[model samples]
Target: MVNLTDLLTDLAAESADVDSLVAPLSAGDWASPTPAPGWTIGHQIAHLAWTDHVALLAATDVDAFFASVTTAPDPARLVDVGAEEFLAPPDELLPRWRAGRAALAAALAAAPPGEKLPWYGTGMSPASMVTARIMETWAHGEDVADALGVTRPATARLRHVAYLGFRTLRHSFAAHGREVPTAPVRVELAAPDGATWSYGPEDAADRVTGPARDFCLLVTQRRHRADLALTATGPVADAWLDVAQAFAGPPGAGREPLSTRDTTVSEVTA
Candidate 1:
């Protein structure tokens, strides 16, 4: 089992880093186009904050959380709310967002070992919550960074990201109407802290080996797996890459090549 405290600490650190990056941006920068089709930098941050709120509710009362909230009508509607939610002049949305995160942290801290909480149509234990949060933050952070023409600071938290990638393999196989591969694929992540984290079987038909950050990027669909130095030795490993999804949803439509230049916000919304 994973350590909840360690995972929470890592997630908190990454969330704070994401907030720091956004706090200094000019108003115009918030609306800059990110890689997720029509989402903006501000939209991405707001989505994170909103998800934290949902997580808090889910931990305390799953039925109410799902009942009270509705997904934004469409991608454009979601982006509008995401950009405007915390920026509205009078209310305490930012404070609420911060408080929600604090509550989420507290919930995780206080949870009994192996206590499962509702999330994304499944039950995740407190330890898994940290993994989910860290993966989400890092993945969305990449969207913001891609919009700004900047790269985020790499970190060892990416082990969590890689694990998320590994977990998604089962879903990927199922989505394609294939049996989940029983053969384990080895994963070697070279973390930013100079720590190496490995998972899966040592002598298997395939392997995925790369810097942790790049592995995170690829699985999240923020960057193409081919662009990184990651290798896949078997058909299952290659198939996993083609359908891997870290977000809560159906499998993505596959990756498209990213433009070297920053995409225009108008182009995305159009």
Candidate 2:
């Protein structure tokens, strides 16, 4: 089982970073549309805050959480649910989100050992669940940051997101309604600071190789595989590259290739 201590700490820091970005925005700013079609900055954050609240429920009240999530519309259609329900301006909306995220983090940090939490897709241990939240936090945070025309620094926090992407390769395939190979595919990434991170077996016949940044972007669907510097040596690895997703839900409409620039954002709604 993954020890959630460090992961939770990282998650809290990531949340704070995103908060800092959105906190200074004006009411008009939150209302601005993002790279995601039909979703304003407010809608992006509202989705995070709403999911945060539900994550807290998964940690503390599993049955109640299931009931509410089941009664709500499909996750895909719920983007504007929180923004619509809160019915407040940016100042009010931001505060509620801050409170909810803080509470959710605290609850996850304190969850009992070995307890599995039910999520929209698979059941997750505390660390996996929090890591997933951090992944979304960073990914959605990217969308909001792009909408604001702001560039944020990337950190080792991306390692967790990358790990999730590698670990969830099977789920990603299944979500696409495709079967995944049982064999493991090796993943080797060059970290920004010149560290090497490896996943799967070092000697595995199938391998994915490249910078961790590009790998993270690929898994998050922020960049299309063709736009990244990744190389896959086997069929499974090659196919996985075409449809990698670190987030939950059905298959995502991953970002399309733009120019050769890696810094630009993709309009993928996933």
Candidate 3:
């Protein structure tokens, strides 16, 4: 099993790094168009901060948490919580967002081992929460980086992302009403620091081999799977390309096939 503490810590560190890069930008930069349709950089960060707040609440009170949430907030009541919180001037916004993140971290750290916290579809243990949050932060951060035309430094935590992707493979197939492959596929991922992570049966009929970061990027739709040096052999391997999800919830409407050279991000806007 993966260490939840390490996952959460890595996510917090990456969030801080992204925040630092974003903080020095001018107001106009906040509204710059990102690959995510209709969401500016400000909106992305705001959503993260808000999600951290919500997760903290769920960790504390699972029942009451779901009772309070709606598909959409009452627009007439607070149409711009994210924007208002993000634009409260840098001095105000940064500290508050950081504080919220700290609170979330604290909640996760203090939770009893094996404690299940309520989430959107199913409840998750503190361990799973770390995975979910890391995936979200990384995926959204990709959007911000894409908008800025900058590349993020690779990190070893991408193994966590790949793990999430591995878990979502079943959901991806089920969403398309296709049979989930019973034939296991071996995955050997090379981490950023030269650590090799391998999963699945060695003698399985299929295999996916590549850098861990690239595999994570592919499943998260931050980079085209074909753009990486990964090799997928056999029918099951090809099926994975048709429906791969890294995040929680239902499988996504997978993207159209792109040429091997397309590295542009293909995430759906929220």
Please tell me which predicted candidate would have the highest lDDT against the true structure: 2
Off by more than 4 A, model 1: 68-93, 176-178, 259-270
Worst 10 residues of 2 by lDDT: 261-270
Best of the two (1, 2) by TM-score: 2
Candidate 2, residues 150-263, lDDT tens digits: the string is 878778888998899899899889889888779889999998778988998988999999989889888988778887899999999999998788887777787767665344
Q: CA lDDT, every prediction?
A: 0.71, 0.82, 0.74
- TM per candidate: 0.85, 0.91, 0.85
User: C-alpha displacement of 240 in model 3, angstroms?
Assistant: 1.0
lDDT of 3 by residue, 1-270 (tens): 667677778988878778877898887887787665456777777777777887898999776677656634653323245444455544566677789888998899899878889876677888888888888788878878878989888887677788888777776677658898788878888889998888888888788888887788778866656566778999998779666777655555433345732334344522
Clash-forming residue pairs, model 1: none
Give the per-residue lDDT of model 1 (tens digit) for 124-191. Answer: 88888878888888877877777787888887777788888877777667765678887788888888
Looking at model 2, the pairs that clash are none
In candidate 3 the C-alpha lDDT for residue 87 amounts to 51
Model with the higher TM-score, candidate 2 or 3: 2
What overall lDDT, based on C-alpha atoms, would model 1 receive against the true structure?
A: 0.71
lDDT of 3 at 204: 82
Best candidate according to TM-score: 2
- How far is each candidate from the true structure, as Cα RMSD in Å? 3.7, 2.5, 3.7
Q: Give the clashing residue pairs of candidate 3, or none.
A: none
